[model samples]
Target: MEIQNKSAGRLIKLIISGFCIGLIATIGACKKDNIKKEYPQGSNEQINTWILDSLSRYYYWAAELPKKPGLGQSPVAFFSSVKNASDRFSQLYLPNQAGVSSSRSLYGFDYAVIQEPLSLEVLGLVKCVLKGSPAERYGLKRGSYIRKINGKIFSSSNVVALDQELLTGRTIKLTLTELKDGGYIDQPELNMIAGLTFEQPVLHQVIERGGLKIGYVYIDGFSAGMASTLVSVFSGFKSAGVSELVIDLRYNSGGEVSEAAGLCAMVAPGLTYNTDFIIYKGNKNGGQRKESIGEAATFDKRLDFNALLQNNLSLSRVFILATGATASAAEVVINNLKPFMKVTVIGEKTVGKDEASFLISDQRIPKQVDWEMYPIIYKLFNAQGQGGYAGGISPDLELSEFTLLPLVPFGNANDALLSKALDQISAQKVNAGLRSSINEARSVSQIGRILSDSHLAKATQSIVLTHR
Candidate 1:
């Protein structure tokens, strides 16, 4: 009923990552002289030339860029033509175009359309409600199930269509069912507008397990300010005298690499500014480059690694909670920190997005180039040269969050995944794990599947190298 999105000036700071280096550095700046505008300014041919220049220089598969390509097609079509057949994350955005889309439209919550194990009725289950978004303000609690959308019931056949409509919609009306005193109860119809500015969904707390105090934090997504946010949380964990830590990234699809690296440094033991973080592999023009923690730290102003280290748990081992939704920058934390510590991943396998991108556009004043490109520019490898999880990283202990229905919120002992992680920490040993990487997608007929988690969702959610 209340309008929250109308006043959102900086929209979706939560969804998209990396702000200080806000994609202002032009990928084509150095080679602008080499690129001559064959057509008039803002013309299709000229715009295509800019796109070509960017891809040719920075695209991971730059060698595949067409030399004698047609320039007459629209920019979007043109981008598709030249991109490598293997590239999945590349995207081109029109000016002011990315801002208004459903992706940026702050629905303020994320949900999974799951099938009731017995009744087999498809229902929309709220996975997480952004800390201060419209959904949370609407009294929509995590673990609540949606029975109807605008009075229409959910079925496998209609769930997918309804989700699409829900995303594109401005005002979303939903009838949700939640776990009450002991059973599910119908709540009143709730209406939310997808217009709030982005707010990162980061929640933290300290839990006592036996004699050890454990610091548990749920990181939903990574962005520019994410590191500084962690700095504060870790500072508290230090104050709490917590001995063990659990990072709940079950719903994080990832954002900026800088933010990801910041998290790595925050928890890993004996890490310094110069610690090797990532090795980037690209085509001819984009030669291989390695970045250290110090180098990656510079991209974000809020990431005070020194402060984070002061608050660091200094654990020799860690437990990371993941799922199919965990990927890109999120995967970076799991992969890159392995050498420095024993990283045990729990929950379902990750959505192996083994690549990172450069946010490309014309950074000139009164910009001549009107489109923005988020092309997969680098194959991200950790310090040990461990890359290529195209299928996803298998969990040391594989467990599905949807294994049980009417899920409780994160950090709740009733949560299957989080509970298992706590059990592992108590026993101080990981259970025999499964290494299978097959898709965890439920049966198509059983539940309407939405391409919600990682494994690609347009662009904008990946490990982006936004600045020089």
Candidate 2:
């Protein structure tokens, strides 16, 4: 996952506070065909009026909205005033703020903070580095450990204070280290500044082990028009005779529903244009809407349905690698496919966000409003009518990457989650580490607590809709 910054405000705040695993909320992001080109300069009074009106019409919990929130309040605060207590992902962004935390602040790397059990020293484990980002330019990578930022070393004591400086600091200097054979060796310092950078969301690899060719796909996020990219990638996997599939959504940020539908179309077999994909049960004004697999896959004829059918893996089962960071769109695939095939999820449970939202900029052309509101719009459901996963989707096999320590990059057989999935596929007996429910209860169970914390872990997912 790239160092993308989501307007997922609270997740980062709490993660930075405790060195706990964090999740971010985001959406497919809505865009109007023509709105006011200029930013709005409306008074708080006018903004609050618009906010209340919009929420009433489209908010999933419109019935729960407060009847009277003083219009004098700031828009951000005002929006929060009416937001349902149950709503976690509904957010209001000031001008240039994240509708989905736009790419303006991305640094092209992602990290997980850990407090090593033995030394009690905190460490930043580089989980991923996007190609061409400053982090990659400085040789940062997965499994690399950050011992110091600027000149301050990490300790169990100082983690809370060091949080924002790492992400929002003007310039960051990192002291890198390698964990080798029970000790750490200091490496050359890496210096860089966070800059605007982006990458193709999908990363794929073909692994051949014991005469079984497995396709490993780590999807960072689902973006609009990703179906073609998925088609091309899966076509390659098909050509190479890849038989099994492992989809790594451990770091997946939230993304678009249609794009998710497209990905599902290519992976799950025996689905036609009318096959059910997602059901949007909206507020009274917005009503329940069902989206078909083909409608989302084709995206107005931008993609060929036959092309998706051609690239379909048609496997009996799929292994989904997930964590608390796996967003709603990814979870949609996991839940919706259950009726059709077996979905074996590895690693920790999911972030448990099932609702969908869209960007609500001023609807008018040459709009009067300067604000963007991402309101909770619908309760999501699948074909079998499974919904209400607000507690998060539990993993079939409970696993944690942090348990083994010194996180390995994706696709490495030594990687904890990948190794577990492979073991299941090959019918290998669970290793001592895996077999002992006692051990899983010890480390992984603890991670489950941290990942499900009300503050640290949030269901920060929303699907962008082109229409109401």
Candidate 3:
């Protein structure tokens, strides 16, 4: 009986051991599966190498590049230092960053430029701003002439180069020439310290022509919150029964794609649209695979059409004032709005750069690295599939000449372009026998006379300089 009991006990022990082994094997299988599915496809060793390489590259690039102040720090470290920095970076990397940033700077004259001859000739205006000082606090009024920056004569040819130099967080010395007695006479020399915080977008009113109220919204870069601002401005115009809108995207280097799309949504209204496309390549085994023609292991996702369709705010007429400075997101705005409305494109062709970029960091490699890449993951296409604008968007109503005006930075909208659009809108009203809802016919008649004045002809000549 004792022998039989001992045998039973041994049998039970063997069974328990088998069950333990099976449980461990099952757990191991699940762990392997999770790793395969959760991580981007690669061998364990290879992924480790890639990750390290990416992190190292990111660190090195940040250290070497001429980035914005406080941006050269480690991404991981930056996020750690600032609460919600990750969310900020995610939004910043998008194409709409320029517009968004521009919208944010709308409150103050964070930056200023000298209006060009055409700008002054067309609108009889010149503008500059109190850099690093708020417009209200410094008493830097609009329509002020920037005679010189740091004792150097300011001109259209050198404004861009000078602006770049000033962005280096240095004190800029300026001589102001206020517009008084109908001419620009030199005022006093003023010293201003510039910083990244001083850059802001401006919206200004130009001359009212032909009973039509005109406004100018100058965009320097597309960042976040631009779409909302645009919507608000247009909505205000609609409420006020304003007849025309002039969007000056001149000197605008592109930023966020989503912001561009958002702007398109506001302008185009009810159109079903797809602005961009993403192409993905993968193996049958659901692993990352290389493409023969393009970059390896990438996939494409087009714009969320449903989102855009739902937030539609269509405009009747959109006059895009562009130049060589309009690029990327700006180009996207121009491209997407073509189908839905009468987009009267004016100015020079845009910078042909529709491609998007991504920031990457991986640590599972031989070296820790992080980097940015302008990967052509997606192609931008209109309804017709024609995407290359290397030649830029040609204006439907071409100006006889072009001008380089440095208006009171971007905020002082009382300028030539807005005035011209207002004139055109007023002329349309008179020819069609349609009266504007906001203004009396008498006002319209007076504006018509002002628009037809011989001075306007001279202004037109000065604004449009023929460049072969």
In terms of lDDT, model 2 sits at: 0.73
Local accuracy of candidate 1 as per-residue lDDT tens digits, 1-468:
135664353366643555434553444564685666568998789899888877777878777677888898988888888877877667788757645344234566677776664355567777767666788778877767788987888887786678777866578788987544544577889877766756664788898877889999998777778887888898888888988889998777788888888788778888888888899888887788988886786555665667767776788888999887787788888999898899999988888888877677798898898788788878888899998987789999987776544466678765668778888888753232321221232322444344243123422245545443
lDDT (C-alpha, whole model) for all candidates: 0.74, 0.73, 0.44
Which regions of candidate 1 are displaced past 4 Å? Answer: 1-37, 98-104, 178-185, 299-301, 364-366, 428-463, 466-468
Q: Candidate 3 — worst ten consecutive residues by lDDT sum? A: 459-468
lDDT of 2 by residue, 1-468 (tens): 233455456667876866533222112122342342332458787888888888888889988888667888888888877788888788787776543321123566666567665445567767778777777777887767788877788765665555456655546888987755556778888777777676555778998766799999888777777777888899999999988899988877557777777788878878888988777798888898887888766766778888988899888899999887786787887887786778999988888778888788897887888888778798888877788887888999998776654466677776779888888887774455533322112243333212111112323534434333
Q: Give the TM-score of candidate 2.
A: 0.82
Model 2 poorest ten-residue lDDT run: 448-457
Misplaced by over 4 Å in model 2 are 1-41, 97-106, 429-468
How well does model 1 score by local distance difference test? 0.74
TM-score for each model: 0.82, 0.82, 0.51
Alpha carbon deviation, residue 154, candidate 1 (Å): 0.6
Number of the top TM-score candidate: 2
